[model samples]
Target: MTEEEIIRPENLVYKKPTLLNDTPMHYCPGCSHGVVHKLVAEVIEEMGMENKTVAISPVGCAVFAYNYIDVDWVEAAHGRAPAVASAIKRLWPDRLVFTYQGDGDLACIGTAESIHALNRGEHIAIIFINNAIYGMTGGQMAPTTLMGMKTATCPYGREADLHGYPLKFTEIAASLEGTCYVTRQSVHTVASIRKTKKAIRKAFENSMNGKGASLVEVVSTCNAGWKLSPEKANQWMEDNMFKFYPLGDLKDTATANDSH
Candidate 1:
């Protein structure tokens, strides 16, 4: 077939999301951020909420998410994305507001903000990226770092006597009454990527419908920080990360309400 014939709409099997710009992502090879970004772009575009969507970008590796996704974006201070997203969502009830945050940003300094915003049932969505280690700042230890996992700050590996255990923030989110939907997902495989995309789309839909708050935690990988190749990182995540942070929905009041 000719190039033009192959390019025909009827022959096209897949295409890049229009909401995703031509900007080359800076995420390292094998990083999960790029896959999650593509999922977000596809979900937003499919929902036809491009013009009405507002994203609160965190101060971590995903800070530049605004550059790749074509949407209204607000840069939040370190660990303050939930607060900013809450405010925007309150002021513009009609707009779809969401926050993209890392484990360090959302579970450490922004813990209070994240908990309170969800507790208060803010009409917004929180997309949490938990890669265990701090990816942007030299692979330092984060609140979600698994036990015995070594990082720049935890060179001797994390010890309960000193660093404490990894925090399961999504589990806590599931307990909150304000949370309409809380789920943990991953993007390491094609099936998981599809599920994660569905989870994100559900969260966005809940936010736009003012169904309280939603938290979608994506268990991710940091190959560069872990000093492993992309392939090994995926294997490591499946072997170790999944053991500590199992995938699936923690809570889903939305589905319950639908059943009624």
Candidate 2:
């Protein structure tokens, strides 16, 4: 009838996933990378892929993801995770290969590689974290940064003439002929977390089944980079980020009537 009693296995409603290491996460207080990482770890454990999965992580805020997850990881050059994953998946067709990358790494510097990998239909999963600002690099502007959003590189706010436009990379991935599934999700609330977890699981499943490429794009919050409190960041994300990058399945070739 106390704290220990409530934490007892018989009364416990939730517990940390075993695949997640005991080490403390380095993500910022309100950042969503930790949540997404936990979900990925849970899915891997639930799927019994701890021994057959490989994660390729690139530079960005979530770059240290391998330190937290108990799995095989290959640290890739900046913006080269997808290409690295392609080679790994080719050599080990039976293993589940995936890439964990951020917006700057995927939508900007690695745009060509990310697109070509998906278009080629490599049997791999891609977990993309889109937090408008570049969180790890002094809050600079990224390709996914919303119009008028201010960042270190855009002190006066992003302008169309100078910044072009926010890239819809998920939609672009969905348009590819090779991608088996592509979905965009967020993790600000319990319901959203559940949805994102499900999407991530689907991505892993698709890869394991040789169904071609699958991309799970997580629209995340970077409170520290945004110069806002955790709560305000979530509120701002819902108010601004969600508008341009709505949550939904961009593509689902597995469910389509036409054969892949």
Candidate 3:
């Protein structure tokens, strides 16, 4: 089928492309960040927050996310997206605010910012992209790098004595009293994409309802960094990454509030 036939106007009625820009993303083929971006944009469009949404992009491969998200975005300093997000949300309490950060940006350099933001009960959404390796800076050793995983800096494999352990960011963030909704999902396949979209929509909706900080960690793929074929990289994330970052809702107070 032709591209026009696939994204026909009728099909785009409710499922329109909320993401912006005509240029293709710089992500390697089969990268999951693109899917995650699409999911977030769709949720914003569905909720009619296109004009009210603001996003902070981290200093990673996703740094250029502003070009694609079509929302008013601020390019934050490395590891400072959370700080920027906090300020933006506070300055304009009526706007829906979020930050898109990678494992290195969020789990490593921005660790303190992330923890404090969640701890402060900031009503913002965090789209955490955990691919285990630092994708933008030549696949360096990231804080979330798995034990025994090899990287540019850790060619001998990640050693506990030197590199430390992989971070369970969602779990840690959820533990904070400020976070109201926390979940981890993946986008390796069509079915997984659907599930991720649901989780992302819920997170945004919860934040809009005055539900404090919400986090949605997306276990993503880095075919180039992992040195695997596109299909193989996805398979690897599904098998290994999912094992480390299990998929599910960590907290859902709104649904619980309604049900109770």
- Count of steric clashes across candidates, in order: 0, 0, 0
For residues 5-56, write the lDDT of model 2, one tens digit per residue. Answer: 9879878877788889999887889899999999999999999989999999
RMSD of each: 1.4, 1.9, 2.6
lDDT of 3 by residue, 50-85 (tens): 899999997998787887888899989888998899
How many residue pairs clash in model 2?
0
Which candidate do you rate higher for TM-score, 1 or 2? 1
lDDT of each: 0.94, 0.93, 0.86
Off by over 4 Å in 1: 1-10
lDDT for model 2, on a 0 to 1 scale? 0.93
TM-score of each: 0.97, 0.96, 0.93
> CA shift at 17, candidate 2, in angstroms?
0.8
TM-score order of candidates, best first?
1, 2, 3
Show the lowest summed lDDT stretch of 10 residues, model 1. Answer: 9-18
Q: Which candidate is the best by lDDT?
A: 1
lDDT of 3 at 81: 91
